[model samples]
Target: MPRASLWFIRTGLLALAAGFTLGALLLLNKGLPIYPGLWRLLPAHIELLLVGWTLNLALGVAYWILPRFIRGAPRGPGWPVWAAYGLLNVGVILACVEPWVASGPWLASVGRALEALAAGFFAVHAWPRVKPHGV
Candidate 1:
């Protein structure tokens, strides 16, 4: 597997762990009343599992398997994909912590915007590779 692919998969797993942890904490709080209103973190947990984990894993696999632009370049332009990775992780980080911060709403909005931009980058990078191969 490629380094990028590994990074994506590992990061996704980490996100999965984080999501589960948050869920467990929520459950614990419900049973013991440790943290009041921990329910607010629900959206963060969902985002971590869905966008941070699932989406990144899918994108990483696509990057690994998709047809390249030329024989010399299997993954096409490297920067855009790297940018997508960075953007996604950063956005997820910001989003996950948003609920606990004072500037949460604004930060969450920015995080969402970043995630959207990351998706756009992935789409643009993957567009040409979507067709069937002649071989």
Candidate 2:
């Protein structure tokens, strides 16, 4: 596996752990009412699990499994994928905190835009590699 893939997978696992922890807390709160504030974590939990975990894992696998060029860098330029990784994580964090901050709506919008940009970056990196076999 590529180093970038490893990083992406590891980050996704961390997000999964955090998301599951939050989910457990939410579930517990439902039965025991430990703290009503736990409810606010719902958005964060969803974002972490869906975008953070799922998207990261998917991207990591896609990056690893995508076809490579016969010459030069096997994966093409690494910066865009790295940028995707960074932007994605930051976006997920911003989106997750959308419900907790005073500037939530704006932050969430920015986060979503960043996430979209990350996807565009990843697409740029991946597009060339996605060709017929033995091209």
Candidate 3:
């Protein structure tokens, strides 16, 4: 596995842990009513699990498994995927904080936009790697 893939996967695992922790707290709150403020974590929980964990892990696996060029760089340039990784984490953080701020909607929107852009960057990195049979 490439270093970038390792980083992506590790970050994803961290997000998964955090998401599960929040989810457990939410569930406990539902049963015990420890604090009503725990309800505000719902959006963050969803964002962390969905985008942070799922997307990051998927991207890392994709990066590792995707085909390589027959010539030149094996995995193509590394910068785009690195950018994707950075943008994705930043976006997830921004999105997860959305519910706690007055400008939440806008922040969430920007976060989503950044996520989409990160996808585009990853796509750019992965596009040429996808090929039929033995090219």
Candidate 1, residue 38: CA error in Å? 2.2
lDDT of 3: 0.95
lDDT of 2 by residue, 1-135 (tens): 999999999999999999999999999999999889889999999999999999999999999999988889988999999999999999999999998999998998899899999999999999999997677
> Candidate 1 on 1-135: residue-level lDDT in tens?
778888888899999999999889988988999778889989898999989889889988998887665565666777788888989999999888888899998999999999999998988888878867742
lDDT of 3 by residue, 1-135 (tens): 999999899999999999999999999999999999999999999999999999999999999998877788789999999999999999999999998999999999999999999999999999988996357
For candidate 3, give the lDDT of residue 114. Answer: 92
> Could you tell me every candidate's TM-score relative to the true structure?
0.90, 0.96, 0.96
- lDDT winner between candidates 1 and 3: 3
Residue 54, candidate 2: Cα error in Å is: 0.4
How many residue-pair clashes does candidate 3 contain? 0
Model 2 residue runs over 4 Å out of place are none
Model 3 alpha-carbon miss at residue 81, Å = 0.3
